[model samples]
Target: MAISSAVQGVSTAKRQRFLRSTVVLHAAAAVTGLVMVLYLLAHMYGNYKVFSGQVAFDGYSHYLRTMGEPLLPRTGALWIIRVVLLASVLIHMYAVIALWRRMRKATAGKGGRRYQSRKNPRGVQRTYSSFTMRWGGIIIFLFVIYHILHLTVNAIAPGGASESPYERVVNGFSIWWVVATYVIAMLALGFHLRHGFWSALASLGANTSPARRRLFNQTATVLAVVITVGFLIPPVAILFRGVGS
Candidate 1:
């Protein structure tokens, strides 16, 4: 009886701790998700300037530094936002990992529902969105790595390039394969954003009911389509123009 009581006490404590952790993770997820979406959209818009060729695009980026004020002091606000975003992303991922471990522990030995097991043998169940979320995250991670090398690290490119943003970018996208990868990455981003955006709102208590969740899901779907189109248009135009080629 004494041993049984001790085990039950531990279990209850674990459950309570998990509930608190879940709340924290969900909150972080909501905040980070919103900020990241905005950051991505801005980044994509800047990249779209590449459609006008290297000079135009590079100039656009240079102009962004000035915040269109034509001033000596660059916009500190932009850099501040970027810093905050980086910090938020770190916190968000940490929370997600914490919650994931807690979930695994809580669900251990529980047989999932039959339909869920069939759909997602890996988890309690796989929602359609869940399947793509993992894939999309993978693509994004890969792209971020390559992107740093090409754009960030100034790695080798089609042209023996200097680190000049202009030289680097023009040389970077000059390859068909590179451009193709950009397209694929943007598509994956669309999938990930589709589920993430709405789900974030839902996590934050924006959509309380099943019907509301469905409505928000449709909204997120539309936003995803917009983001995909917004990203693809400039690249597709550049590809057709053979600017990089």
Candidate 2:
């Protein structure tokens, strides 16, 4: 009996440590997600400058590379932002993947039954946004790589290669298939952001009351709409409206 008690106590301690680590990972993922959201907002703003014309757009792009001159080398500030974003992406992905594995393991242990919520009449706590979260993330990941290669690296230009950032925007979006791919990716991003924003806030302990929950839901919806629309406008306008032309 004493040996059994010792083993049980050890198991309980290990479970407690695992739970604590899971919580930490949740917080880390939430914080990193918020960081990426901020970056997206900033990037969306930059994308809007394309409507100001090629010179203004290219100038803004140059400013990004030359930001903090005298205080830092050319592209130094940009590199700093890039490094921070990369670290955030890595940490966020690691935390999310780790939690997801644990969730899958727990579900398997429970005979593959998903936890049900009282709020859900279907006996499942799933939302459309949550349902598509993993797949949407995969789509977004692929889009990001293609986006970087097409625009940033100038290695996989759809229409043609160009040194001008504004030209790149106009050329790439001018292609029908490119625009379609972008639209699909943006829609996926909207769904991802809608759920991710609320989840992040909840993970950070912000969903305290029903009222707060409603507000967070609305905020998440608005943020997702704004970011998704904001990003889509530049490409759509450049393609159909001939804004850059």
Candidate 3:
């Protein structure tokens, strides 16, 4: 009996440590997700400058690269931002994957199926945004790599390669398939952001009341719509209206 008690105590202690680590991962994911959201807003604003014409758009790109001249070398500030964003992306992905694995493990049983709730006909209380979160994240991840290659790196231009960022935007989006791909990716991002924003806030302990929950939900929806629309406009305009042409 004494040996069994000691073994049980050790198990309990291990469970406590596991729970604490999970909490830390949640916090890390929340913080990093928020950081990326801020970056997205800024990036969306920069993208809007494309409507100002090629010179203005390319100038904006140059401004980003030379942001901290004198105080820092050319592209130094940009590199700093890149490093921060990369670190945030890595940490956020790691935390999310770890938490997801824990959730799957906890739910693993009864033929490795998730729990069925009688309260909901679908077996789980899941919003469309939440339900699509994992797949949407995958789409967004793949699109980001393609976006960097097409525009930033000038390595995989769909229409044609160009030194000018403005030309890259106009050239790429001018293609029908390219625009379609972008639209699909943006829609996925919208869904991801809708759920992720609210989830991140909740993870950070912001969903304290029903009122706060409603507000966060509304805010998440608005942000998702705005960011999605904001990104889509330039590409759609370039494709159909010849905004850059």
Give model 1's TM-score versus the native structure: 0.75
- Using TM-score as the yardstick, the better of models 1 and 2 is 2
Local distance difference test values of all predictions, in order: 0.75, 0.92, 0.91
- Cα lDDT of model 1 by residue, 1-245, tens digit: 99999999999999877756777689887789788888888887787666566678778766666773544358665567768987887877777667667666777935233443555665456456655775787788788878877775677565457756766776656567877999899889888888888878978999988899889989999989998888777656555655555
Better of 1 and 3 by lDDT: 3
Question: Per-residue alpha-carbon lDDT of model 3 for 48-81, expressed as tens digits?
Answer: 8989998999999999999999899999999999
The 10-residue segment of model 2 with minimum total lDDT is 109-118
Model 1 CA deviation exceeding 4 Å by range: 1-20, 68-75, 109-125, 156-167, 242-245
Model 2, residue 12: distance off in Å is 19
Ordered from best to worst lDDT, the candidate numbers read 2, 3, 1
